[model samples]
Target: MSKPSLHQYYLSLIPNLVSELFFYIPKNEIRDDIIEKLDFLNTTNIFNTIYVVDYYKGPIEFKKGRDNTRLLLKDGDLDKNMFNLLEKKSEVPPHEFNYVLDKYFELAECLFYITNWMNTNINKMLPHDDTSSGIFYMQSLSYKKHFEILVKNFYPTKDIIPKGNFNALELIETYFPDIASQYHKPAHHPTEHTTPTPTNSVGVQEEIQPVLKKTKKPPLITALEAEKILLEQVFNVDFKKLK
Candidate 1:
């Protein structure tokens, strides 16, 4: 068989990388199917002991994006777009999802530090000298780049979630006159400094898009009602003199 290319070689390590990234889910809460898939990711069976954590369901609840697919990141950074798509594929509960994404966000930041990802200036702290944390930092960017390519290859669109008669692309085409221009992407994918344009399903520009159906659940977000109410009450007092 032909040898795996650099991208494919990194691609193969995802399950293991994810395995290393995530640790400590309570045994009772995890479903057998998810647990099974994750368990054998590195080893044959359940050899490692599952650690327990105090119950805390994470904040990234499922909501429908403008395209009506499961929305994982509402106001979260565009870097988190991958996690939004992952909600459908993994089908894990909110808490577990939060745990993994928290881990991912910390590591994924390596992609943005185009020049000094390793903080080599302060490398004197760690054990080694020349390689001093730079190798690990380089590896973080490498893994993040490959993961992006993998997501685009597999779950490239909201079409993966499959709503009723109409799909995400068709919905966008029918409504937005300028949609065609926004849909185009470059032929060559870059290894670093990639950014997603704002769009209906992209977790930005939420107000600009129209929703044909109700969201999966209202966004798991809340604003301070007291602020609104206080302002309205203050305004109302001035008008009380008229009555």
Candidate 2:
């Protein structure tokens, strides 16, 4: 038989590896089906970032974009048209645009880094008894470790109760319930905090509650709650506001 290409081998092993990883994941933390869905998405190369709306259900959407995409950079520095297209196509709320974009970008960076590493090291990662498992094992371990760091650092104030060793979804849900409700309609009206109006009633110029500070939080996130903040503040996907 002809020697199988390294890429082909890596691709072939991904499914089984993903399955095994999912099997190791705690059930109550996240539905097996959801993990399967995520696996499918990753293996299929559909979305770079998978938004787990509800483990009991399915992903709300899969995002596509470069991990390095930045919002703060000038439009000329980026694929402005592409970014605009995503903004227009997305059902995300206006307020939550920056948050969502930044989160997805960060996630893309993580995934891209792993995938790129795999691609670069594929030659040396041939099938061997000790190292034959390929780079996925190490990649998965790194992902898990980084994921823990992400969870802790992102939501420092939130209470975190570990559901299980492998139940990342449960840990996420416990820390950020709003993310669980991402697919659900908003339950309340959008909160409006008033600021000084730019123009005075008499005509004098005054400060106005401009919508500049819609999002209020750190950008480095790894948990679903970070996703929620992005969706609500940047995308404006709040059900309450929609109603």
Candidate 3:
């Protein structure tokens, strides 16, 4: 049988990888709240658009060349619709916002490492132009802008107390030890931090539940779809070729 494409291989790995990284992030009240909010965001189509792509041309007129150079994250806007939703639902303190931002940064870094590994080992085997350069560049920009806005607004010139040491190898080892031992370099490490317990505010929960119930899709479906899109972008492989 022909071996799976580079995209297929990476796609198969992402859901577990993302889940592991997210879970391994040292738990704290702020992180918990962030997780809760993130969970809500994932339910919305706007979150998918933020990650996937946004249209450049709209009713608003744009300069001729500008329309073609559609940015992944336009004007450093991290989905204003989603942001507005978050604002309306939760009154997060600046410190907690900073805390959540730091944790989210850690998640982004973990994804970067995973993609970097794919580039080095797998992409090298494929045609040079077939490398995931363009896809990674755009996704990196999204990661940068999302975090940049958070830092500027919530923790400008502030020293963020890191919640814990993120030893990615160790995390993979703990959750998928055999996979880790085979694929990861040796080394790893968590601590719970004090933060406000989530009160499950009525507004956010109300918004979240309907979608979850309406779709009746399994929770893992989002992760699977996310993996499919990333793989398609990187390798132009059919999603069916994955998993």
Candidate 4:
């Protein structure tokens, strides 16, 4: 027997949960095109040209999804077409993308509190320390671009994601002053802000990726110039293993 997919798990869990906020279904019916795109991520075909090797997940044009060179089906589903798209940019339509991305998040091993408390007053909720990296501590992440304009505009700068580590005190006083005002005041980054922009759009961006740039050997990813490239460019990094 195999473990259940993220979808299956959500279905089983949804029935028991009290909060209806955690839902996978779109308010309006899901578009057939989006359904096809979502379904495509579940199917893994070695001959499909999506994977360079015999398995899924890897490093290729981008660096985040897998440790190797090929892109993960799950991650690739959200990308825009290579011609018009870039990595980490999800294509799922804004209206339905939120429902879909939440489905994708099931794959990420993270704490609910991390997303839940990102804005609210950490000092009010918990003890704070000057040296300690607050709960939201993070310099930046790939998904920041997708955040709705409201969260984006909330910050004075265009690029809202910064401060590698989110400190409770810092977030309340400095970082997300508008929404992190919860408890003490009001909070934000509502569920609606998830619409994919260059990034948010979600997994069904209906993207058509070009064939992966395969490695010399399926089992071992090696290149003559790759050593220098990987060392200088990709080493110690989680994404983009190829040169």
Candidate 5:
């Protein structure tokens, strides 16, 4: 049988794992398949960036481009609407956008690992003292720094706080009680508590029925919260459990 194209393999692995974790597929069965495919792609250098390709135009648009470019254009020239049709035609549900984003980060991690390994091994193959061209040195340094940051920030071990024995969510709850509570609460409904109708009473007008101005809340706990929670949980101390 013909080998699957790199893009096909990547596209296939992501949707399923994303579906499994987010779409409620059985974890036990899909877990192995997900890991295996992710590993295969990693080992084979299949994934780099999540690219939305236009088969008609034969170019791939990296998702990162969305942040800086106008919604209508990416790479300064390509029209984003062309891809809008593909997005519309795509079978993936809109709700699964988060899943796709998570998978993209996962794939980026795998790419970082593979790229780091390649850079290290290739350096070993070259003479130690070889003073290469400026472009080569620049590229090497750039990639090395990229991999270093990726490994440092997203390392699996780093995810475990106290350097190893704690859940990130629990840590956040412990360290940032206020922030965590805010995140859990439903979005503040502005319409539910608009300014009270301007009262014409000369007196205090019954205090104007204090408009229950929705309290502004932080979105999430910081990384430090994760660390604090890890310590508390591991020691079996009541370090502020999340509501």
Candidate 6:
């Protein structure tokens, strides 16, 4: 038999990568049919874990960019358009599978970095009274532009690959448009505190109330659910039956 080319070799690593990624999920609780379905997905040669890693870099960098926009030397430099390194396929020599494998692991770690960052940021955002309180209005536009590039340049899978019923990209797309909107939305600061209400006969001062303005709520995300969606969609493994 002919040896596997670099493309086929990195392609083969996906199933093992996915297995390790979701090792915490209990195996016995999964339905036999689901297990069979996953096995079939494992057989697919089209999808790669690299695509999953590429999808996450923008969202991760978006938060980082907004947090320290002034400090950054250039826009969107945090992740450095890491996905672009993988752009050339036909140009890479078949014997360079080891190089590709190294990059795969690096991007894999990046994916985890992004996931953990989102978990932290979402938790912090949830308790805030103003969902868009600390958001940098100008910086989020740059972030939105980066996100647009990611969506437009996404690599296509092989022609025979089946469309996944669930997709992580779709979830990210849904969550971030609202995020972009939230950041772009005007911040309403109270111009002045209302005049204190008159006290009765007593010497106590009445509380002052400020005018209220309606604000849009930030999208709520569960870390576990996000991780599950990424695993199932990126790896093409159906986990609907995993209790």
Say which candidate scores most in TM-score: 3
Q: Count the backbone clashes (under 3 Å) in each candidate.
A: 0, 21, 0, 22, 3, 0
Could you give candidate 1's per-residue lDDT for residues 1-243 as a string of tens digits? Answer: 896443353334233333211111123333455434442322433222221111233212222221211122212323344544354335656655444443333333222221122232223323353332433344334343433333233323333322322232443333332433334555354333333443332211122434435454342111212211221222231222223
What is the lDDT of every predicted structure here? 0.31, 0.32, 0.34, 0.27, 0.30, 0.35
TM-score, each model? 0.22, 0.22, 0.29, 0.20, 0.23, 0.28
lDDT, candidate 3, at 127: 33
Instruction: State the displacement of the C-alpha of residue 119, model 6, in Å, after optimal TM-score superposition.
Output: 11
Name the lDDT value of residue 101 in candidate 2: 36
Q: Please write out the lDDT profile of model 6 over residues 159-182, one tens digit for every residue.
A: 211233223333333433333333
What tens digits encode model 4's per-residue C-alpha lDDT throughout 1-243? Answer: 997553464444322111111101111222344334432222422111211111323222221233432222312321231212222134435434334334333211011222222212223433453322221232012122222222323332323333322222332233233333332433364333333222242221222222223433131112212222222221232223221
Off by over 4 Å in 4: 1-102, 105-119, 133-243
Q: In candidate 1, residue 187 scores what lDDT? A: 38
Q: In model 5, which residue pairs have backbone atoms overlapping below 3 Å?
A: 171-225, 171-229, 172-225
TM-score of 6: 0.28
Q: Which tens-of-lDDT digit does each residue in 1-243 have in candidate 2?
A: 896543353334222212211101112333344445454322543222233222233323322331212212212322332334244435446545435333433442343233323333333533233332332344344333333333432323222322222233443343233333331445343343222111111110121323225655333333333333333432344524323
Best by lDDT: 6
- In candidate 2, clashing pairs total 21
lDDT by residue (1-243, candidate 3, tens digit) is 997543353344333223211101112212333334443323433221213222422222222233324443332344452253246325556655445445444544344433333333333333343324444344444443333333333322222424322443333323223333333333232122222221111211112222234345433223333433443443254544223
What is the C-alpha local distance difference test score of candidate 6? 0.35
Model 4 lDDT, residue 192, Cα: 35
For residue 211, model 3's alpha carbon misses the true position, in angstroms, by: 47
lDDT sort, best first? 6, 3, 2, 1, 5, 4
